[model samples]
Target: MKTSIYATLAAVAFALPAMAQDMGDAANGEKEFRKCKACHMIQSPDGTDVVKGGKVGPNLYGIVGRKAGSQEGFKYSDALVKLGEAGEVWTTEDLAGYITDPNKYVEEKVGDPSLKTKMTFKMAKNQADVVAFLAQHSPDAGAASAGDAAEKPATN
Candidate 1:
């Protein structure tokens, strides 16, 4: 019985790191976001600049929990609009995938190979980090909060 208990404890210990990895490191993401400043910016609703950047892309203030291709005053590709219409809500997992490869992610989510996005820059690494930065600034990211997480029952 002791041996079985030890094995279970070891398994749980190892699993904890994996779970943390899924959450991403917001601090590291902020640093990595420097590269994205060439095209994107994180401006708040009050017009405060969270990250003063180029306006080539849409503002990413509340990217988390937001609908895809729904940025106001920004014209998105047909594919992105279709994604929004298809009910593509931005989750942390999906945002990581999208930043890794926008075209591929959209194609996978929308199921259209011919579709393309204006975002051509694909992050080779640290995709999770960048996503975490966006989530940090996302005030409406209710699921991203630790309080909300604490309220949820842990699942194996």
Candidate 2:
């Protein structure tokens, strides 16, 4: 009985970090999102502007749970399109990593060092916060949050 209890405890401990992926503070994320505004905008399909921003990047209204590089009207890099073709979907955890290092993430995902992203800026900190903010605008927010929790590796 004691051994079984210890095994259960250990399992729970290992699962905690995966469960915490969607627990980022959305309020703080909104503040951290200012850094992303210069390139991206959060606009709804019905023309509602959640956060008015630039057109340099695609509209981020439904980014969470979206397939990478699948946003209409945005010309994506070949690398991004290839990643999407390889079944890459945008989850909060993946988005956080993408923001931290788009180039490296693309390279890793596509296994091509020559592939590069159009995005030059990188968000090294407050990634979870920003992803949470983006998630709030996502139409499939619940799905993105829940799916990501199951799919992402444990984070420190």
Candidate 3:
């Protein structure tokens, strides 16, 4: 019994770092976000600038837990609306895929090739990092949600 318990504890200890890496490093993500700042900004609801950038994309303050296409005052593409309708609550994995290729991700999820996003740039790499950064800014992303959500029950 003692051996089994030790093994389990050891496994969990090693797993924690791997899990955090899989979810992407939030610190690295912050640096990677400079690539996204040209179009997107992460600002608090109180109007504090998290990462001040252009207004081309909607504010991404709470996007990780936010419903897709639902950022206030921003008109979403039909495909994004469809994505939200399809029940996409942003996860880091999904968001990483999205930053890599918005149109393709949308098409894959919403199944509409014709609908395109105003976001034209496709990030060639570091998508996980950028997503991790975004996740941190999402206040609504609690214990049961966002980048670290997978680790929640495991840690408990």
Question: TM-score of each candidate?
Answer: 0.81, 0.79, 0.83
Q: How would you encode candidate 1's per-residue C-alpha lDDT over 1-156 as one tens digit per residue?
A: 999999999999999778756677777888999989999999999999999999889999988878999999998999899989989888777888988899999889889999999998989898887887787788656654435532321210
TM-score of 1: 0.81
Model 3 gets an lDDT of 0.79
Off by over 4 Å in 2: 1-22, 147-156
In order, candidate lDDTs are: 0.82, 0.82, 0.79
Report the lDDT tens digits of candidate 3 across residue range 1-156: 999999999999999888777767777878888877888899999999999998888899878777889998998888888999999888666787888989999999988899898888898987777777776777656632633443441211
Model 2: per-residue Cα lDDT over 70-91, one tens digit each: 9999999998899999888898
**Model 3's TM-score against the true structure:** 0.83
Better of 1 and 3 by lDDT: 1
**Pairs in clash, predicted candidate 3:** 29-129
| Model 3 spans with C-alpha error above 4 angstroms | 1-13, 143-156
lDDT of 1 at 116: 94
Which ten-residue region of model 3 has the weakest summed lDDT?
147-156
Q: Report RMSD for candidate 2.
A: 5.4
lDDT of 1 at 12: 100
